[model samples]
Target: MKIFEMLIPMTWEGLKVTMSVFAITLIVSLPLAIFVALLKGSKNKYIYKFTSAYIYVMRGTPLLLQLMFIFFGFHYIPVIGYAFTRYQAIYIAFILNYTAYFTEIIRGGINTIDIGQFEATKVLGMSKSFAFTRIILPQVMKNIIPSLGNEIITLVKDTSLVYILGVTDILKAAKSVSNTYSTFTPYIFVAFVYLGIIAIMTNILSSIESKFDYYR
Candidate 1:
């Protein structure tokens, strides 16, 4: 019972850290991903190839290695090395890694869109931008919501990876308590905390997905 009592505060602190990484990554990565997807889809072959290579590298590598490299390797760089804190390094890695993923998700969504819709918009004398914004994006978003939600949920769990940089995230907090008390209960408590977070997110995402059902 006393361990449970101790678990509460520690878990709360860790939850704050986890949520911070998740929120910042999601908020920043989504828009940046849209831009990347556009670049990858560009008519200019060089732009498309460059963006494709970037996405390929980011997706091919493990995120943990990416985080480690950003945290440790950046110090070797001349000008930019000194500017990064561990938190900044983690955020940067998360943003870049997830942006690559989201770019693909967005691209897949865009591809799933029927070419006929574009033609219909062209017939209506709408500009490409107007057609995309008005007709294409909504349907793409609807198609992509399920995939995006899964990524968001995965990110919540992935935030624990920040512990590699000694960020004292939720799992790290639990580990600390487990080590001090010589009890495994902290691990179990932290697992439930993670599940609770996932549950809440799943609920929210489901609500958002339901809102898009009108598209069907």
Candidate 2:
């Protein structure tokens, strides 16, 4: 078979895996990020300590090691061993990793809101929680959209890391196709697929930024 023929099929297969992981990560991470950001910003000492340690551990570790730990390490445990599949393990690892990163981003957005705004909301008879939801978070969302978009684009490329757990993601698909055909054209095809997805993401993010331009 010609190299281009092998490239197309390989690229298609890999793109599926990459998109699946990327989608799942974004869905799971967004809410988790808000929760963690709140915890990290809380005044309670225990909450601060626990969330700080969690973020440190996640950020400090290599993502590949984290995936391997989740995929392989849990099997040695008592009951959960038989329950986790490679796909589930990979999903958990990606979600947790991205959640930590996004939490920091979100916390930055929250911090950018002035304390004066919160005080003014309180003076206006708004409860703290109500003020956060109605007044503060909306503006934070505007600030965060661009940074979050960057993370989403990065996730598209990082999905290739799933191959560490034997997941057949796009880069792995390219490798398989290359090995089958004994050529490098499969990688070129895979790169094009990545470029196309990233291009689409850029357009979507740019649209979002324009829509939220009042914050700027």
lDDT of 1 by residue, 1-88 (tens): 8777877888889889999999999999999998899788899999988999999999999999999888888788887766478899
Q: Count of backbone clashes for each model?
A: 0, 1
Question: What do the candidate models score in CA lDDT, each in turn?
Answer: 0.91, 0.87
- The CA lDDT at 96 in model 2 is 91
Q: Which residue runs does candidate 2 get wrong by more than 4 Å?
A: 78-83
Best by lDDT: 1
TM-score of 1: 0.95
lDDT of 2 at 91: 90
lDDT of 2 by residue, 1-216 (tens): 577676677677767888889998999999999899999988999999999998999999988999998888888878766546888988999999999999999999999999999889978999878888788877898999978988889888889898887878888988987898788877887788789889999998889788877766
How many clashes would you count in candidate 1? 0
Model 2 TM-score relative to the real fold: 0.92
